[model samples]
Target chain A: MSTRWLAQPERGNRRLIRLLTWITLKLGRPVARWLLYPICLYFLLFSGRTQRISREYLQRILKRPAGWRDVFRHYHAFASTIHDRVYLLSGRHRYFDIRIEGASALHAILAQKRGCILLGSHLGSFEVLRAHGLFDQQLPITVIMHEAAASNLNAVLHSLHPEIRDHIIPPGTPDTMLAVKERLDQGEMVGILGDRVFGDEKGMTCDFLGKPRMFPEGPFLLAALLQVPVVLFFGLYQGGRQYDIHFEPLADSIHLDRVRRSETLRPWIERYVSRLEHYCRLYPYNWFNFYDLTDDARPSHTAV
Target chain B: MASSPQLGFTTASGLEQDLAKLIVDSLRLEVAPGDIDPAAPLFGDGLGLDSIDMLEIALAVSKRYAVELRSENRAALASLRALAAHIAQQRTS
Candidate 1:
């Protein structure tokens, strides 16, 4: 159940993905979405590792034994998000119904001309926000992610929307801080996923879903270092083409005295884990970290 | 529990040493307080300290100096020298 599973080359062939992306774009969303059921089944049957990981995750969330159908649904939910990414990246978001809450809080922060951090998790699709025209139309958002993790999938998506490539800030670069600082100074939002720890990335263990798991300290540290407002964002799929996105202020500014570094960071990480757990319960299948949710002190290749 | 404290002049270098001792004690760092370079970065390659360590140092500073070290105040925490300068400014104010 190690994250090593994710680091292994992605299962889908490049040509196959190219073909599927073409079909998805040409057939439109509805017909493309139908392909998810069979694709879900194919993975469920062929990929035992994914099935096992899904069952393990579902067991904890459901608080009971998870059946094959539950795992199938989990795979389907994941595939559905991938399928929908086509439309989202292409600016064809009118096909889906999206509900946004706590948008004023974001507007209020932006009104101050002080850019804030949008901290998201792997629980749901981060694309839902951008697809809704929140970027450029409402405010600018720059995504901070490791470019190498999903190079293949990213290549396809980048090809569809060439402008998005410019907004990405890859981690581990010397100028990463300068780039982010420049963007923030310009009153633009920077989004980062906070749940997983990338390889060699320093992280601390915190209680998550009644167990201890490692959460990356980098995002929180960056937020505190930058001394910007931090907001929690969740983009959830409520089945079909409907998505519910929620935003809540997590911290005004993360300040920790060296002595109380762990003490302060512990509570922040816990609060985030609790919020993630809450959504996982509401939409169990939406939580998609296909690995054992245990303490990963050593960095995972998939995390970045 | 004597209230009266001995008052003496502490030189700039002396104050820096004291601050370094505070950081070492606060973070339980392996290196000796005297080993820390005043001009070297407190983080990254200098002390090999991480973000959490920086936070711990900030907390110690706040408790001992009664001075708030915010994340935005990068100049204050850039290095031991910068931090000492910030502390001196805070004491004067």
Candidate 2:
């Protein structure tokens, strides 16, 4: 049902969402924490399938005995994270406290005036990038993502935030490839969600946590072709409306033979997995990936 | 049929036997290495593995073989045999 809202015409809700973003900006985050309860309830009551899937992932990934309390905590935290991400895009980071560790490293890369690939995962609010984007006015960021298959709420946000929607590149097709290449040639950075599966075989086999998972190699492969430095980025939600942004240099732009270039990608994948593992260990609730696609029993598009 | 490492085998064949054990343990498969006829299929006929299962196997092979599987190297036809050759090369190198 919510999927219908995603494809709904945006004109009617444009004003409403703009007003919501303003109200969110004004009210501040402490007052914002109150919204978590009802949002938590909505997931518990409304999304029977999603809640079950999350629980299953938590159970397998955690790989230890977890009581109902632990399970409920994950439910509450997941709900809370979603609510916070909404506030974040509306300028919550400025008013609320955010600890950023590696902005300078990114700035240094941007200073080079060469293209860069910034990789971030779904462990926290990728929206934090919007704050940096709007503030720094640095190189433009092209984000590669799967087109949302559901969630009208996300659709509304995307449409309202044209900055986000326009910059996001959906999987497949040569057009997006040309766009990314264009951005690279112009000395801009491209961002990608390296964790999710596009279900294509065009990804590298990676050991995520202790298990082997298929992670997209598109960004790294792109970096090699364009001869750009690949920088790894982490934006994690800290407690109480706060986030910590970290950046690491995966590799310097270097001339490489074909074989050397592909092997070069290994360190970048290792760095991303290492950083992602840290966040996952601390905030198990916030890593919202449904690892086993089989458990994703969300009502199908045909069913809707 | 795999030339049995259980009795005695060629060195390259031994590497193949070891890789089979690594795959079974890493994926926690129900079948043993010797039980998995190297010529037998990995998908519907033999082990009934899917792509997801293949990914799991690929990761295990990458780690133990000290070889990285790149984006271009993925194809269903390049299943156990391709993986065995990759491991053999990595071991020799």
Candidate 3:
């Protein structure tokens, strides 16, 4: 697929975002959340492309035609997470009830003293995991992000807790691989969003939600190169100050032999896509890929 | 930056040729080792290589030469000759 998401402009300006964040922080969550209804309605009416994309995704997962209410719910879920980030970043995580399901699996991998990859998607609130790592567990976690895509929004949000700026590693730089290697060697957890493909980076087409969708192979390749275990994480927002964070062990180690590289990587990508589909079906509104996922000029290629 | 003495060269040095072979072998490029000009860029339009190819070559170089490539030394990735020189310098230091 193409980088259509990258081309889409940031929705809101910095001043409005800063104002909203300031209000959310000062007024508390319950009072600020009252604002999301009008905001979601505004997007649902104005942002036609996002509304249509959400309806299409909901139709596929819901196995029926999605109604306006469903689309509104999806927008509300997305806005809620964005609002929660204001609190989560400011180190007020205790305000929400986050239920983590698979701690033992993560602990088992961590006990080995070898760094592991936590593969996540745009399914829900990744900030929940970051907050948990920062506050509850005291784990040194670094997030790999594409900073240029949403520069304005990121700049404003990052200013809330400037320390998070130090933990970010942007992809596609000369230092990207070396920095990841150093962190993995130090036995620190590295988080990567495996769903989105950026620029011309290589990708593999896999069956997702009963459709052939392309997923980035960069995260898996990095895991293979670093020879570390991989774990799947999803932080599903359950509405009104509740999040269900789930983690599942993906692979103890990934070894892609050069000769059969495409064949070897196929099953891993399929497994990841299948798990993502499972969660998307479980929590229908959690998926936040606001663009047409299957629309691409390139032919579907199983090989990366 | 001023044009260095190494610019505009057409042929590969001995170390550059070795690195060219390693890159061609690891990335499975169709180009012959001798055909890869030492001064030509290794990424972008020059060799038509991307960031993924850079990682593969870096891994191969680390395995073969026992030298870790750092981001601060990104200039080494400009061409075959520069990388070979960087590796050689790093080995002695």
Candidate 4:
């Protein structure tokens, strides 16, 4: 994390990206599709941060044998998938085929009026849910992302896209539970990336994509105590302006006696990891958790 | 920033244990006081606490101790040592 983009807004970066996207859209989808190359190459070459992640992920994903080329190709494909998804929403394509398989499970939980916890991972462009053509903005979708200080790219997307801005729920101060609980009480469901290590409580180590990665148990714990069902959704990119969105019921009943609370929460967390695997493996390019998911025997108990 | 030193009360360990109990009760963690080293790291992986639990823990700590625990103060949450130290330092006579 040496080169922090947190330094400056760098408006120039935004302008160039806007210009490129505009030209690509104007020039027809064929050439525009091809344009993903140089953009990906630029990021992959410059963002040593992401490249380093690609190398590590390759180790777990390609258990047998993998070379630099495989990692490079995945990065390029990832970049292209990002570009195309952006293009699809930009009206280059009218609508995508996003099929969410388990709406019944979600609807059932929402019926309780106690609120539901949509535990999501950064598996695919979550925004693709909008492309599903069934998403009603009226549905409160609060996404708890880290406090963003940098990334002009985020600023542009957030400002320009209604779908993006409408759904963002940022938590800065410590009182997240009160806020989330308030929202939940309003008969609304809030989504958080529970898979990521939020600098909160000590996190748990679980198997992810055949490797051990630490995951936060707070979301499930909250869900259980709240006595709500937790359903895992898998957003997969099926290409050609289509997505295979599937939701699986992880736990219909989460309450456990005091003796079984911790023991009970483990499987639900693995359920999250399992769904992340399905989505990430199916749409390998769209999963964006590139952080160093290593357990550094390193003391995490230290203060942040 | 830490203020003038306050000598450890014999009750400091008890206070830490009580604080840890509040944490376990609220977060439903499978941890025992013996498992929580008052001087070791608490959030990363030591106690298997996640970021969300961090927020909840702060709430529990504040609610039980009447101490204002702000997440922004990196120094205040440096580790269990720091948190226990904070709890002890701010304890009212």
Model 1 residue runs over 4 Å out of place are: A1-11, A133-136, A148-150, A295-299, B1-93
Regions more than 4 Å wrong, model 4: A1-12, A24-30, A44-49, A84-94, A130-135, A147-150, A162-166, A256-261, A295-304, B1-93
Off by over 4 Å in 3: A1-11, A148-150, A297-304, B1-12
Tens digit of per-residue lDDT, candidate 2, span A1-304: 2312211212224454445445545675567566656545554556555556566667766887655555556656655555565655554446546777777888898888887888777676666775667545664777765443343345555554556665666544224455565566678888877676453324566677666766665666566555788887777767666677777777776443544544766767667787778778876776756445342222122100
Better of 3 and 4 by TM-score: 3
Which lDDT value does model 4 have at A152?
47
Top candidate by lDDT: 3
lDDT of 4 by residue, A253-275 (tens): 68755576567788878778877
Candidate 2 Cα misplacement greater than 4 A, ranges: A1-32, A45-49, A56-63, A146-151, A254-264, A293-304, B1-93
Poorest 10 consecutive residues by lDDT, candidate 4 chain A: A1-10
Native contacts matched by each model: 0.03, 0.00, 0.33, 0.13
Decide which is better by lDDT, 2 or 4.
Answer: 4
True contacts kept of 4: 0.13
Give Cα distance to truth, residue A256, candidate 2, Å: 6.7
| Model 3 local distance difference test score | 0.79
Q: Rank the candidates by TM-score, best first.
A: 3, 1, 4, 2
Candidate 1, residue A170: lDDT = 75
lDDT of 3 at A279: 94
Candidate 2 residue A83 C-alpha distance from true site, Å: 2.4
